[model samples]
Target: MAQEMTPTQLQAWRALYRADTLLFTHIENTLRARLKMSYFEHEVLRILDAAGGRLRMAPLAEQLMISRSGATRLVGKLEEKDGYVARRNTPEDRRATWAELTDDGRKALKEAQPVVEAVVATFFADHVSNEDLRAASRILDVLADANPNDDGFDCGL
Candidate 1:
């Protein structure tokens, strides 16, 4: 059997989990209340925008840390309900599909960016010292690298 965590290790884990939950909840609530956008929707747009406004469905799902079908459904909702995203099939590979952000999506993201930034500043960055912030970032990076998803796509860990 594997060794169990030490008391310090357990405390660190709990602290990380609690901090993540609180921050995520606050950000999600702020985004929904201020901009009428779900956190996932904003994340989808953010990822696509970072990828030059278009990405393959599988990679998008990978980046979103969701299942393929979940990505499809989310993209469907963004497309059908809000006209924020569009799907296109590549002629070179009929089986592969791409999700592209619409101009409206860009506009929506632009509007929501400030809300997210303010929340991050107020709830997270503002409270942590710069030294602790850097240390936390490095520690989180190591944790993410150590525990990677098993999905075929590169987790970028």
Candidate 2:
């Protein structure tokens, strides 16, 4: 059975939720306004770039913390509309597909990198001390370890 959260715990949860939502919204809005890129799209490109400009579709979805189909749609848009990504099928496995970052994607990421860095620093890093950030990082590690799966959380919302 699930244990009921104490008042303090509930308050902490609420605070965390509000902070996450607000921060996310702020970053999302800023990225959209300045670069015309959604956070997820930017993340996809970033992840692909980090993976040496190419990754299998499943792992890409996993790293993005989204469903495979969601990754597919995003990749499709990046491929067709933006020409930022390309898909290639593996010879060993006909079903396996790789998402590769295009030259345009690299240029876009180069452009958006500063925007993301500045926004994160101004909106988040400025407010939190190094000590606070370290403590938060430890706490977040615990919370993340409690649920180690890579699957998305569905609250039926």
Candidate 3:
């Protein structure tokens, strides 16, 4: 049996959608102005930083929830901006190229960390009570656990 959501539930869902959009937009703008990094660029840099400063192209694409072509384009842009570099991993697989974080990329991420943390704390964390945050985390964990391909999702959020 399925029950229809009430108007209040519908409204809440809509609010959640709007909140997600606004929060992401705010963060994007902040990062761009403060660090000269777009949201996607920041995400790529973050992933590289987490992967010990390097990641295979295929895995990076999967982690970023983007196509291989899309990842290549993003990597090209990052390389042009001197944030990172792509190199052929001939020993592992001659056909595949890996993206490695440059020293400048690490410096950039470190510089942006404070601003990013402040924005996150101010906009997202400050509004929620401690108990509510804990509950939301638990719910999110449950949802993530139910997904079989959790690693295929973007790491930005």
The Cα error of candidate 3 at residue 38, in Å, is 0.7
lDDT (Cα, tens digit) per residue for candidate 3, span 1-75 = 889999998897788788778888888899999878877787788999999889899888887777778888888
Query: What overall lDDT, based on C-alpha atoms, would model 3 receive against the true structure?
Result: 0.81
lDDT of all predictions: 0.90, 0.89, 0.81
Give the per-residue lDDT digits (tens) of candidate 2, residues 1-157. 9999999999999998998888878889988999889988999999999999999998888777677888899999999999999999988998999999999999999999998898888878899999999999999899978976455642221
Q: Tell me how far the alpha carbon of residue 134 in candidate 2 is from the true structure, in angstroms, after superposition.
A: 1.1
CA displacement after TM-score superposition, residue 72 of candidate 2 (Å): 0.5
- 43-145: candidate 1 lDDT, tens digit per residue: 9999999999999998899888778888899999999999999999988998999999999999999999999899899989999999999999999999879
Worst 10 residues of 2 by lDDT: 148-157
Q: Which predicted model would earn the best lDDT?
A: 1
Candidate 2's TM-score: 0.93
Off by over 4 Å in 1: 152-157
Enumerate residue pairs that collide in model 1.
Answer: none
